[model samples]
Target chain A: MTGQVRTVDGRVAGRRGQATRQKLLDCLSEMLSSSPYRDVKVIDVARKAGTSPATFYQYFPDVEGAVLDIAEEMAKEGAGLTDLVAGRSWVGKAGWATSEELVDGFLDFWRRHDAILRVVDLGAAEGDKRFYKIRMRILNSVTNSLTDSVKELQAKGKVDKDISPAAMAGSLVAMLAAVASHQKGFTTWGVKQSELRPNLAQLVHLGITGKKPTK
Target chain B: MTGQVRTVDGRVAGRRGQATRQKLLDCLSEMLSSSPYRDVKVIDVARKAGTSPATFYQYFPDVEGAVLDIAEEMAKEGAGLTDLVAGRSWVGKAGWATSEELVDGFLDFWRRHDAILRVVDLGAAEGDKRFYKIRMRILNSVTNSLTDSVKELQAKGKVDKDISPAAMAGSLVAMLAAVASHQKGFTTWGVKQSELRPNLAQLVHLGITGKKPTK
Candidate 1:
């Protein structure tokens, strides 16, 4: 036991720990991309990670916990854009930008984190109670950023004041989900990325401005 | 073989066919209410329907096909409402007698079809291509109905002409989906049904009228 511990100590411990975590996440991501979250087990993830089940448990309590970690990490990466938006005036800096930027950014996020998004969607829909709570936390963070933008627009009289920011926030989040859902169906419908961004921008613009741009 | 065929024909061909279909759908409804769609298998559905796996194929080709049939049937039943709306102006008989009536009808739809809605949400997230098509069809139908209403309202000078009817229509559909998704998370968030209708109505009014309600 001491020898085994010594072998995993010092620089090797730190290096191996980081490598193991990345390997696990990568394996989980690959599996979740092709399979349903509920169908993927810890043992499967462990095997895919090139580690034993005991080694897998050393990091996550269970498969869901690992997924939650993946979700949190993805959320953190996506959170950067939200923070950037937060630092600016919604009406002047964010709202005035072309709808393409918004749509493109959103699509990019989905594309970059498609695997984690798949797991998050699955966890939210079918995972246990804890996973759902984590899902809400992610949603709330995203919604808060949107609500802030809406609030800024309302303050500048650019948006309708009569509407509730919370509801609008909900609508925005749902629209994003709808877009993601559409993207998931893109291959089947023979829709290409070239067509997706424009259509999505139109949809988002319509939702936000309540007016369709004459293209 | 002829006797078996005759028995199947006599008992499972006409009214029996309908009964078997209903039984299968009912079993699916029950199973889906408690579990996610992906988790529900054809065998489980057949067993719950009190039939063998072979018999399950008689009515539907697969689980997705069966659920799609059920959704189509529900959509058909709801089709009458759309047709009635199509034949009249927003203030006419088919358009909602009162605000409460409108809210009640919407809530009733959710409550009645909670199981199907769950299936839709589950299937929508899955990489299943058919699920998105089904969702798009529902959205298109609702959008058409809403567009008619928007056109009437615009003609009456009640709705802003600048806002495109199609955009508003998409928002309305997205709103309904948001409300349903919110309700799905109700247990974890402790959301009440009483709060649902008013919020939904307010959002609808905002999207359609482009103005805040007096309430």
Candidate 2:
């Protein structure tokens, strides 16, 4: 069973408290979208949420704590990304479809949660273990599934044996993430969103199968 | 010809003024490394630099302005990355070496400037055009050359005709940048630095040539 949501003072949250906490998080999310992460303050979040800073503090310790709570929620949602690759064939026409769908799904996920993900990425880059683990938690779902697919293909002699499945999968996922974070960057380079998906899927297919997709 | 450095007030910097400016930038860089970009303040940077906030204001309007100054300097240095790919052969054994060296050099540059690059990336992700342009300035050295290489390969029927040269090159550059930023993530996944280089090189080779390296 899921544990009850608790306050910073160790009080179990009832429905009203939960609503207040969620409102703070939602307001914080908006602030993150409209300004730099560093500029987000508990006072601003409280004001935006129509609450008090003491109420914000009661729910979480600081800006980072609240950010972590949001990232945790997003990570749970990210776990569903595994279905984009789980039990999917990586052979021929079917393989190309898998790659395309994976690219589509992954990019959409990143776009939806990019503001929080950016902060998570910065925290991780700054050597914050909690943020690092949360980022890993999100990416691991798809990464683990992709790794399994690569290992399976390697066993079938379809992929180069020397290719480290983990490294390959990690790199591809990183590519999807990097590209997703900078999706607008591609536009500056004259590559459209529609044009980018198939190319990424192509690279994904090539990385996994070591052969061009049949499609 | 290069223009002389100037203060925020548009006064051309003399030797002493330029020295003070450089000192401020150095302190700002150190602060960036030790703290999150969001928490860095101009007053703190001025204090760290052994200067007054007024002096800091003389050279730069704020922390973001100083950060942009540093990013510009780094991007100029990053233009040297073009040598890693310009006129490089993408055939047979030499091609493999090119891939390995590119990965090596790119990773080193990114690791060296990871802190500032993180801010640049965050800015770009937040849709700031100035930061995005700077990020592109750094990446385009390698990307432009890589695009030309891909285009050449396609013309000769070595790479896939359908592949968008810009997209492929952009994706590859993004992969290198992403992987470099998250090198620690790889170690946590049990992939060593030594193991990662070859796999990335292999990917770079496969992506560029559309075939395994002869090596």
Candidate 3:
């Protein structure tokens, strides 16, 4: 659905140019994963991509612009995260399973795109609207689905009427994201992945269903 | 008791020297608040502090070392957050109040130091040990207290025997922190601050006690 890829100079990128652009992005992503965001420079990225800084500028305005390109792509893929909670059951054993799968899937997604996500998070936190918009796009998918689930349960008089579905869903999602980002910290603190997952799932189940999971 | 302050060159900082050092830190903190972390340079901070780059170098190795100093100071103050949860009651109306107050205090602290916290979060997520340690030190006080609370509840046969107190406490604290950092995001997304607090408190209360708050 994205329009034709174009260079910063308003020229449509042909097949060869697109390949070069993608290569630059791949190198940039790798650099981001390995180095501090502040230290990444255009010349270094271009060198790694077997090109010059001029070519890098041809494809994008600057490092931030190129990073935005990468984040947008990840956000598109992150939209599928909606399925992790959408139309899921929140009753009995099925409820526990749903929560478990949701946590597992969400953590996996964050780990996969963590480098770009971290940059997006920092940018958004620093009050950049472009970054904030991308962060919202990626998170809104899961948050909206979870909110719907809470609202449905509330409608059936299962969850408390006083609950704010949006806030609950938002908080739960934020917890998942935070925990996912700091998975290494938990491990070092002596909580194994095996135990961590279930406890997190239980918390999710409790947050949504307002009752401890039977499992 | 901490040792006497020393400069990078191993000389003990005299009163005037310490004043100059602190001024550089104050300028760095202000620059961090107003600009992107990547764009903050030693020269700018020195200029803002009415000092030369050579004078700045006398105290700090670079911009990052100076930032670590600021973060270290903040972490020391953050140790006080322990009182928010330590020995607090988690029963009936008191439990709900505890949860609300924890959320309130944590969010306020995050807002107060968000600029530095954002940098620390970015650094930790990027796998820097020093930043990770600071992040842990700041979160540990409350996480440990909550962990003890859960374990106490479990020992009394109040919480599920299967619950891992550490995991539950870590998850709950992580949720609080993530939500705190993104308070602006929530308000922008239509969750008012007033409704946001109680919903978050409910989630915290439920995660900790495995039951909806009576409030």
Candidate 4:
């Protein structure tokens, strides 16, 4: 009975630790929303989280590590929808259903997290090598999804069978990435998101359907 | 005749100054190709150009200025291509022909300047706002070209009536920028230019044609 109480106590402590860590991350995200990623410091993050420097250190080695953790979390959230479609078979109704759902879901996902997506997009442009790795991981996730969709389309005779799946997959991923980057830069160029979204959706639809809309 | 000789001498001196500046930019590009942009120093660029630091300073205020000059040169090259395509109508036969020619020509241009492209691409990501501005300038050139194409298409009733030409132009420009960024990361990911070029072309084609090719 004593041993059981010790295990329960340990579980509660772990949960509390996790809660603290998450609170810190949430504070960091809030801070980053209004400032450039490079300008934010560890002290700022710690103070904002209502935690001591020592507690911040206990959770993250440095500000970059914390930012990287947030970046990875954002990447995972954006890539999760794609991963779901990548694991499915590439033929029949299940495959088609998955492909359409994933594509539509990804569009919505990018729109929802446009701010964090802007951060990650700009972060990938950093001269650091790790940014490239993070970017490639994100691209790979999108690539896997595109590959599954392309293969399924080809199998169903919906897409050009002559085009290589890998090439099509790469193209789709590239297109989506471009759309995301443009969304990030819209404000600077005096563009509204409402004005950009329909064009982006039209481009995606054009890529898959192969039919140019008649006026 | 004596006045003509003096004028010729002045022209010769001006030409020599221009050549020296070009040589410095060439040297900087070479140095950046083998190293990160942030790692490059003014002394290294001077030594490579076979000039003194004072001479380098005469032309550029700092390393960032020199980088910006090189980026401007690239933007001019990209813009020159658009100027070449501006007079042609982008409808029916001319539309398909102009796009194919442009894509093929661009692929060849990127292939020839892969080293310089890599340096510019890296520099843009290295937190140099000037480099980023230059990249934006390049994209604007592409945007202008697409805008002209869309205008021509709309005049002929070839494009969708609902989509604004400006939005379509933005999307095409974004797509190209994405392709360029992905191509820049290719070597770091063990992907080759030969493997990426065709995919990039297909992506451009997809964006322009609004048709997925049937195998």
Enumerate the candidates' DockQ scores in order. 0.21, 0.76, 0.86, 0.24
Ranking by DockQ: 3, 2, 4, 1
Instruction: Name the Cα RMSD for model 4.
Output: 8.2
Q: List the residue pairs that clash in candidate 2.
A: none
* Best of the candidates, lDDT: 3
Q: Write the residue-wise lDDT of candidate 1 on A1-215 in tens digits.
A: 22221122233346678788779878988888777555788889889877888877776767766777788677667665464335543332344354557657666777777767665665465535655665566566666776666676677776666545656565556566555654655445344656556545554444454444444
Best by TM-score: 3
Tens digits of per-residue lDDT for model 4 on B1-215? 22321121244326677777788889988876666444578899899889998877777777766776677777778766565357764545555566556656655565555555544543444334665666667666667777776766667776556665667677666665555545656556555656555544444455554544222
Docking level of model 2: medium
lDDT tens readout by residue for model 2, B1-215: 98998878889999999899999999999998999887788889889989899999998877888899999999999999999999999998899999999999999999999899999999898888889999999999999999999999999988878899988899999999999999988997798888889988988888888887778
lDDT of 2 by residue, A1-215 (tens): 77999999999999999999999999999999999886788999999999999999999999999999999999999999999999999887899999999999999999999899999999999888999999999889999999999999888888878889999999999999999999988997798888788889988888878888899
Superposed by TM-score, candidate 2 places the C-alpha of residue B21 at a distance from the truth, in angstroms, of 1.5
- The TM-score obtained by model 2 is 0.97
Lowest summed lDDT over 10 consecutive residues: which window, candidate 4 chain B?
Answer: B1-10
Which regions in candidate 3 have their CA more than 4 angstroms from the true location?
Answer: none
For candidate 1, the chain B TM-score comes to 0.75
